[model samples]
Target: MAELNGSPVSLEDLQTLALTNYGHFTSMRVDDGVIRGLSLHMERLVRDSRLVFGAELDPEKVLGYVRQAVAHQSGSFNIRITVFDPALEMGHPGVEAHPQVLVTSRPTGAMPPPPLKAKTFSFSRDLAVVKHMGLFGQLHLRRKAQLAGYDDAIFVESDGRVSEGGTWNLGFVDEAGTVVWPDAPVLPGVTMQLLQQAHEQTTTAPVTLADLPRMRAAFATNTSIGVRSISKIDAVEFDSDDPVLDTLRKAYAGLPDERL
Candidate 1:
């Protein structure tokens, strides 16, 4: 279920969001009342709030709202926190910003599927940095990929430079067995950041669709799926059991969890 602030989501809330849809959000996995990289999640909210809303977000208040929304929850849950101003008008430029925090929680499985088959789409998000509510383009590409019998979509620029996946960050294992991330603009997922910190060999490099053929292997990362190997992208097939992916899985699992 979803709650805006501490109350259940109402039709009025939906209507308000539909008007402008000017918001940013973050999602994470809460396991046994603990979460990995909780601080990073909060930091993302605060940072994005400033960038998108031109206002500061109170991390403590956001945390309180999250705790209250998930108070009765247990076991593993996927939680999302959305920040938006209720009074925001569609095109009004003088509206006072009073950001509201919406928290949603749902039960989740223990792990992501073993691997995924993805296809490349020559599309990218409007503002690639912020995790805003604007997802029409990305979602469209994902739907198209799924309809084509692919697990997901990998977004690439017109020049074939891979930016990220539809919802997750893309990581490639180079021929030298190094975890290389696309240097292009991305949402900078919290899990991806944590993985970089946990693994010293991880580095940022510009990976394009043309380079996939030469890549040793590839993987996708997000809060929902910690690290999922990619079996295929377009006509190129990858090994799911690559040693580099195994190391990445271990690195993500070794990170410390924080109390909610």
Candidate 2:
């Protein structure tokens, strides 16, 4: 995150930073408060920490650290908790803090995409079963996609099948008006799981970019944007203007404050 160009970063600073500033994060959108997927995100942090550091890190300890660090403030934002060998992973020598624990948050901006969602690779770069500090390529790809005039990009593995987008899962209307998602091993995203189970329109299968033109509409699913439609990809416009997208948005959009 330090290389994010003027992005203020601190080691173990989950308390100071909002989740938006951090990639590979878990933000709650369906419910209230900062860090949308607090419980699930915390669970992943503990699980990933142990896998990478071989240290049985406690979620409570991490939470306490965050509370102590940002104890004076209160606000909802995105959250990223990192536990890895900052030295070995980055190949930085003489760094005293190798296996460090870092947590940070960033304020969420306007909620534009709705009903349709995307998951950049950074958020799901590790084994679907493990949430480790790995997915660096995702951060790079998202920026690249935007420069090319796209809001997000879906990940397609070597087999050329679709995965998720930036931080959301991809769902689309096929030529037949059938809604589908190509792959499943998506990291345990709270929003993804909720909608997949709740909605009858959602389905999982192997989709390819070759299938793009046949799509009548496309949207990404996640907690942050809820269900957001996509306006364009590779400058080729897709229909993010479907009524289903709005239906899903009303069913799951809004900030925590609105709920209370």
Candidate 3:
């Protein structure tokens, strides 16, 4: 289901986002009536709106629209809140903007997705900090990886530093059991932030594909899939059932949820 500003969304309401694709969005998993990292999600939306559209977005108004969209739904589901202005056209997008909220929901997938076997690609998204609507580059790499018999793709910079997966943040467990987050220009995912807060032994450092062999295990984090183990990346196999992965998963799941 989809709604625009607390009402049903029509084709006209989505034209700008569909055609221009000049907006930012946040995806969250809503369970019952609560959400994990709801505040962080809203903060991302508001912050990205200002950076992408040059306008301020009311967090409370966006939250209200989300609550209204999910109020009737039951059980756990995934929701994406997109902020865009229909009045803004591609020719003159710099004008003062009044953004609107578009909330869409879908059924949640299996928790802890299957272990992923990813291939590395030399690609990085534009505006890596903001979760903007542009996805052609990310998805294209993912498709190429899949066609080559891989589950997904992990982006590596030309300088050989690992950044992130196509749609998630990458995390590593060193031999000493420290959780190492890649220090590169990537989207600050809410789940990754929560894991950093909950996991006591965590640090940020530049991780290269050469450094993967020294690591004990690796995993990916995102809202839909809380923590998923990475079985392999470009032939460097990791123990998908590693004990450290289990600990990280439990740590993330233990985080407190906020009421929507």
- Candidate that scores best on TM-score: 3
Give Cα-based local distance difference scores for all models.
0.88, 0.55, 0.91
- lDDT value, residue 64 of candidate 2: 63
The lDDT ranking, best first, is 3, 1, 2
Minimum summed lDDT over a 10-residue window in model 1 is located at 105-114
Where does candidate 3 clash, by residue pair? none
Where is the poorest 10-residue window by lDDT in model 3?
248-257
Candidate 1 residue lDDT tens string, 104-189: 88777766568999989888687798999998888888899999999899988877689899899999998888889998979989
Best by lDDT: 3
lDDT of model 2 at position 210: 74
Residue-level lDDT of model 2, residues 42-110, one tens digit each, is: 776667655544456566766665554444445544444555443342333233433445555555545
Candidate 3 positional error at 216, Å: 1.0
Q: Which of candidates 1 and 3 reaches a greater lDDT? A: 3
Badly placed stretches (over 4 Å) of model 3 are none
